[model samples]
Target: MQVTQTANKNVLDRVFKLSEHNTNVKTEIMAGITTFMTMAYILVVNVNILADAGMDRGAVFAATAIAAFIGSTVMGLLANYPIALAPGMGLNAFFAYTVVLGMGYSWQFALCAVLIEGIIFILLTITNVREKIIDCIPSVLKHAVTAGIGLFIAFIGLSNAGIVVNGATILALGNLKDPLVLLTIVGLLLAAVLIAKNVKGAFLLAMITISAIGMVAGLVELPKGIVSAAPSLKPVFLQALSVPAEQIFSLDMVVVVFTFLFVDLFDTVGCLVGVASKGNMLDENGKLPKAKQALFADAVATTSGALLGTSTVTAYVESAAGIGDGGRTGLTAVTTGLLFLLSLFFAPVFTAIPTQATAPVLILVGVMMASSLKEIDFSDFTNAIPAFLTFAMMPLAYSIADGIIFGIISYVVLKIATKRAKEINLSLIILS
Candidate 1:
């Protein structure tokens, strides 16, 4: 009887401990869930693109899904941070549409770019050169980059929502006549209302709920939710890595890989810094903990993704959505990572989530990201000019790297023109 009583007490103690963890760890889990939902669109588009590229669609999806899961889980368990890693949206588009379609490069050669760039990224991380570059960036410019990402993401949300459609002659416009567009507008309004009313998970909840209604009303195309297992690694992995020596020596390849490296680095850095700030994870000196580990994790994830036959993997800015929802610690990221892994088996269900649903979430995230612009020092032209370039160019240029480049170039130009070139950091000017 005494033994039984002890066992019961032990179980109760364990339960209490778990309850405590849940209470304290609730933020991380919420953040992970929020981030996962925001990025779920990748599962659909990625598979389709791979299939069109004459690659094994199922294999690519399986690989990407698995790599993302593992990378995200490790990042959570090892780093105690809430960033996500996945095949990058922009890079993949560039690979399929630009490299394959425009440049007429073989898919195999494109894969070579992924491998080389990833290795370079890893080297950059280990050498501490990456850190120095980041440190050299003016605090104001860094903030602008972060804020610019917000604008860039917001533009993505708008484009996805059909609220803005890109065209050849005319740039873009709202689809006022489309009922689906009307529904999206309504959903956006609903999400805004809920957010203004101070509802927790308002963005996520609104996105899922409204998109479901739109699907049921036959306004949105519902994916059949069918996923076939095409998990081949050796062939595709080899194909992606086998760049000819000649190709590597070519100026064009050099340019492409350099571009890829530059974009991935700042994109990841901007995301980490932005989300960390929002989470209040910055130290007393305003430095982030385990930043190297986070950077290494991202670099490794990209390489692993390439080996597994997917596009470049990088840290996600969408993680901010979860940070805004009160996620802290790697536990939340682990939870999210687990979900992505499980998604391989349940791809159909996730694919069922309509675009209109995600639109509201993206819009909310945009609002959150863009709000940081208010924090920039508007009085100093040095700060304000770069901030403007970073903020405006993101959406306008439709590229994060372009926005960052414009900001960097403008900063250098402004400093030189104002005869305050000496005030600028030498390393930063050189890098720009």
Candidate 2:
């Protein structure tokens, strides 16, 4: 037993640089659990969304788990970063609603476009072009992106908990009388208190406590079964690769590929910068070390997701939860990946977790990340305007890429109008 323990410790220390990052195995494991619990909703949500695109629900479930496993594992091992990757939410919605339904393309064709986009990403990363783009981002904007994602995540949590509802004019308060919403409020308060008290594992404890209460109160249902065999992926995997030759060269196909590539590029960049800033992982130059590796992992995940029968895969912003839990190394990502693998067999049990339980964690993480806003120079109008737009537009527009687009455009316009064009780099001008 002692020998086995020593061996495991050595491997973790060597592979994850655990000591260098000031994280221990136990902390990484806990952070991994916290991160997984917060984002696990994607497994069920992805299946439902893709099924709308006429894919098999069971197949998509297995695909989602597998893609997550692959993405997280690659990120952990290759990038040595705590970030987790999965089939992204908005991109999946685009695949279902716009690409397949609106454009009237087959699901297989959409997968082909995703695959091509991933290839493009790989080429860009290898050529160091993507790294240049990341380097061009102003430090102020990076801080804003981090805070922006916090608001975005908080918005998601509110929507999930039914605290924010769709109104005739805009978003309105949900029914305060609703039991689930009430439970979520209680959970949020409990989490906030624990966080304030500096309790370890506060987020995870809150989730478990709320989930248990939900189950007992009949707000959440118990799993029907604990374990089940995974569904076959051969059917969808083969279908994705069987793209027609004519479709490959079609103008519509080019447009679809460009759309996928564009969205994934900015989304990954925003998430990387945001989560890195929160962890203090960015260097003095405002660049993430091993960024190429992170981008490469995302590219590989997207390609692999296409083959595994899912939509575009990218780094998840929920990684901030792990970072907030003191996950400073890849070991956290590895733990999350391992858990995803285990979840493949225990899908029913994991899917049973109520959104109200996870919602509190998201809100708390948002609060943690929003703290980065203090780093921005809010006194300067030129800096403040773009920063505020980057911070607000994320949740408001319901798209990270769109928020980034608006931020960059505004930043460039303000700089040039103020006759500070020299402060604006050539790359920013080109990007604009």
Candidate 3:
């Protein structure tokens, strides 16, 4: 009887271990799903740029999607952080629409720029100067960055939903008199209702449900006809390399590099600080474990994306949505990374997720961002002015970093004028 009891105990212990392992795997999978849903918007907009670049549009897209999958997956499993990576929305537009078309630079030259910028980012990560730079920013401005991004994201949602329309000829700035706008408003209200009712995944589920209803009601446009779809497989990369080696080494290369480095640096910093705080990743000192490792992952992802013939890579703030769903660690990141890989097979499906559907998630994100205003030390004008400058400039200046710079300058100026120079930290003043 004693031997039998021992055997049974051993079996139960093994079962418990198996169950624990399964739970971890499930958590990681959930994280990946959240990550993929956040990044789906990129597939819609990025394809247009590659199509115009005189490169094989199909190949460029395939490579981009693949690289995103690889980069995010690696970041999740290795760095164990819940951040999503993809060809950044703004950088891609700048690369394709502005740099290549607007400035008349060749696509090869653009790729070179991405490469150079990515390398610079990597070096910054290795030296840990990036953290120092982030540290030097006034805490008020740091808080403002998250809130400003939230507002900016909400603006993007409203604009995408067609709820904020252009004016007619006379007024030239009135609301658009469109049915799509009305439909989206209805959807927003529905989302609010779901949240009020305590529905889980209220934001995401509301967007999907409303979009499906819109489609059935003839409020949204379905593709007109069967489009010639490309196969979802990896094709030859570096075709641009064959075109001309000499063109890669040009003055244009310098511009591309700087653009990639500058944008990704601040962008990633904002995401890390923003999401980490929300996710409870920060320690008592506000430091995160392996933070430089995570930054390195992001820099490497951007460099890889450029090599894959896409825009500069960036960390997605949408990863916060997963945190909202109870994601606590790297398990969530691994899940997000796996979902990005799976998305390649369902590219067309991802393409079909309407902008209206995603808008609400961003709206919710905006709300989360605005939650920071309470943290601002509004009692002091020195803190208040800089914080206010950062918050207001995000949308008006049309750049987050620009707003940050304005806030820093204003804070320093205000402190000096108020005879509070001693209160100002030398490191912050110098860096700002």
Worst 10 residues of 3 by lDDT: 15-24
What tens digits encode model 3's per-residue C-alpha lDDT throughout 1-432?
Answer: 999977764553353232433334444445456556756777666777666765566766676776677677666655667676778777777777777888897776676677768778889889997767666666677777777777777777776776654555421322446666666677678877876786656666676687688779887665444433544434435533443555666666666666767777777777777677666666665665667878888788877776677778777777776665445556566556665566556665666667767776667767877787888899988998888888788766666666777887898899899998886787768756
lDDT tens digits, residues 1-432, model 1? 999977764553353232433434445556677788888878778767765666777677787787788778767766677787788878888777777777877777767787788888889889877766666667677678778887777778788878888687555788678887788788888889887887877767787788688878998777665664445555576676577789877887887777678778777777777677666676665566677778878878877777778878887777877766666667667767888887877777776777777777777777887777877899999879888998788788877777777888888889899999986888888888
TM-scores, one per candidate: 0.87, 0.98, 0.84
Query: Mind giving the per-residue lDDT tens digits that candidate 2 earns over 1-432?
Result: 999998999899999999888878989999999999887888899999999989998888888888888999999999899999989989999899998999999899999889899989999999998988899999999999999999999999999999999998798999989999999999999999988998878888999999999999898898879999977776577577788899889999998899899889999999999999999999998998899999999999999999889999999999998888889888888888888878889998888889999888888889988998999998988889999999899999998888898889999999999998887899988987
How are the candidates ranked when ordered by TM-score, highest leading? 2, 1, 3
Model 1 clashing residue pairs (backbone): 27-327, 28-328, 28-332, 59-230, 225-348
User: How far does residue 432 in candidate 3 sit from its true spot (Å)?
Assistant: 2.5
lDDT of 2: 0.91
Give candidate 3 misplaced runs (Cα > 4 Å). 1-31, 168-177, 221-236, 239-249, 422-427
